[model samples]
Target: MKAKVFIMIMLFVLFLVGCDSEEEVDRKVQDHIMETYGFEVDITYRESLNEGNMGDRIYQVQRKDDPKVEFTVDLMGMWETKIAGDNYEIQEEAFFIGEKFVKKYENELSKLKISNVVFRKSSGLYIETSYNSTISNFKEETLQPLMEFINLLNSYKESEKFEDNYAELDINYSNDKSVQLTQIHEIKTLGQLKEQLYQDLDISNESLKAKDEELFIELENDLRKLGYQYEYGLNSDDPRFESFGCFQEFYENGECNEGYRMYLKGDSLEKDKIFELIQFLNSHSSLIFQDVIISNSKDERIIFEDIKLIKSMADIDTVYSGVNESLGKTILN
Candidate 1:
């Protein structure tokens, strides 16, 4: 009887040991699988419109490996804004009447709108102004000299005034390629000269003299071709203008914000569009900062200087469902 009892105790100890070993093996396998195919996601949730209570949670997904994957929960109807323009590269003192005088002169003398544009691409100073003619405007003779200047600037890490002759566009193409030569200039005045004399004066059609109008039309057609809704804005605050690449929108708070929105055809910018935009905003709240960074990586950072990240939450599932039902779904698939 004593020998049988001892044997039974030994058997019980073996069973427990086997069970523990199995558990350990299972845990390790699970951990390895999780490490292999899993993704670490940081999700931030906002609690209220004004209460501003927000929280972030880290989640492990089974199959995402891209380190740069971003998921946005857009709440407000904010879409990306398309900005097009040129950069100014002239000296404040180089102009006969100084920088202010040059600017005023350009605004008064020139037909195309010359706002504060800077087009320095590893070069001294080149501007991208919308020419009166649209023939994919670069050539070898016109751009070569400017590119050489730009190369010099990159190498020196300094800004030096090229000779008045240095500002000339000497485009030369060894191969068959369209190079925009006329649009580049070392100074605003020189660029204006190139645009007016070679670019504008060369155009035979008198009707095409108006570049700003032509550009607006081109923008309209391009947006339409891209399947975006388009319309002219009579009222300054109309959101429809946003769809046409206008970023200025005034709010009730007496502050100005820059953003754009586009909608499907037959959709109202105020009703269905607003809700859709709101959903996009909510989903992409975190992306706002990143978008700014990417869009203006070469310039000054976009400071939402006065804007506050207020908290807000509606039922996300409900908002998403409503968007799908109303928008009829996007063509991303």
Candidate 2:
């Protein structure tokens, strides 16, 4: 009983010491940032790395003055620390101006939701929108230096500085490709640069819709050719049901959060059509459909197959995607 009490007391003392040490580290970091940058800060988060000379502690610092500005700092030695990242990487009031500017033209941005926008000053706007033909043109237009557009956003301050020189378009597709635009500074100024942006976005949205429609038509034709009279893209009253591949209605992860279904054309399922359709559906696994249903013409009473695609735009390899059969979601490689 004496030994147990001693051990518990030692553990409690160690815990208090650990807590005190953490408090000291936090104070040291906070003081170092304030002293160096002349700005108050909040330690957003800290990480303890395995290998470091003075200390393994790393901190993500957020400026009290500029909420958008963030940088990494490494603690070195016993209480010494310095900024290890470009603290001014996102400056020029980019977040302030970008948010303000975008708000002015809220109605213009039909597809480009505010959340999908990342306005990095001097680096142009990074938008996580879908891909289409206009993306190519957007590449051309935006690549010619974002100075023209940045000037428009900055004009409110009556400053004629060309800040934005690059543009990045993140496409949330299964392929997962990013279209970055970098270009030489052009001398000409486009007063209608904002208009051009909206114009390109509109075209892109239209083109994407047309592409989906074309694909739908093609799928129909292909199914008919396979001798399967079927109905594709059914709707449901379930709140969880979502038809995937819609840029207008994308999830936070940038996936088409839509449900899909294909049914036999008539109440009675033809064995040949069912066979062809089942084979096709199994092979038609894609990242777009989060949940899919394959049913007969009768009703939900005859759900032939149910599919769930697990994936995220940030990392695709971490997900398991396949058609489960006989298989109460048979987990197979």
Candidate 3:
């Protein structure tokens, strides 16, 4: 009789061990949440049984650090038999903080609209102006040249003798590759800046003029070798050597149209030649002058428009997009 009682006790203990309890599941979920988010959490599980012994269990988890943040995990189960089958399957997982969904709460920056950016060149300052009342300053190391240019402008601003350069920049933000930029500089200030840059290069105005005349001859010879005829002329109104422009006309299908108009400017004609030659070599592979006005043909216009600058600005837009993505992942997530 004692042997029979011992056997029954052993069987009862085994049955209790075989049954899956809500406490066991809650402990597993609590451990998982703490390991994943570095937060201690409390998990409570409740189960309901159906007619065929198929039932669902809901695990409600609350962050111990913040009771307001909570989530739920739903587990579905099916029984092959009343006592033997306890096959549990996870039905759904959801997270919430207060009344808001966790996933939506994490990606808040994805909804941000970046409207405009203001680039100030004085003292190397590049500031992302207010967006939703938030202004951000860029890292100085990343924009050294821009900061230097801004510093130069600021220094000039403090100097009473140096005239202020009135400049205007028109930037057209676009969704596609087509971007337009127009920059206008005061003629006097532009001339002064050119003179200062040339002085730094140790090239006098007269020497630069002579070098330009030589470059024109070499350019014409290069064009002739490439089976092209060119006409070179200086704008009579702006008699400066830098104002020289070349025009090439090609007769195609009995119609005469301008083929290429090249202009060289700046302190060193040699530097300009090198740049133009490199560009000419790569012209076949890419668009050489995609909406870029290299120089002003007439003295009346003192504008410098570069497609390359537009590309640089586009890169800034990309950086902003990355910033938004990072903010979403770190702060909201």
lDDT of 2 by residue, 24-80 (tens): 767877777667667777778877633344454567767788555655566554334
Which lDDT tens digits does candidate 1 get at residues 3-116? Answer: 999999998786555332423433433354346434333333322222131212112212234322222222221121111211112332232212332343454324332223
After superposition on all C-alphas, the RMSD of every candidate to the true structure, in Å, is 26.2, 12.7, 26.7
Clash pairs for candidate 3: 106-332, 121-150, 122-150, 123-150, 123-151, 124-147
Q: Could you tell me which 10 consecutive residues in candidate 2 have the lowest summed lDDT?
A: 311-320
- Which predicted model would earn the best lDDT? 2
User: In candidate 3, how many Å is residue 254 off?
Assistant: 91
Clashes of 3: 6
Query: Considering every candidate listed, which one attains the maximal TM-score?
Result: 2
Off by over 4 Å in 3: 1-15, 48-55, 76-333
- Give the TM-scores of the predictions, in the order they appear: 0.18, 0.36, 0.19
Candidate number that wins on TM-score, 1 or 2: 2
lDDT of 1 at 152: 34
Error of 2 at 253 (Å): 24
The CA-based lDDT of model 3 is what?
A: 0.34
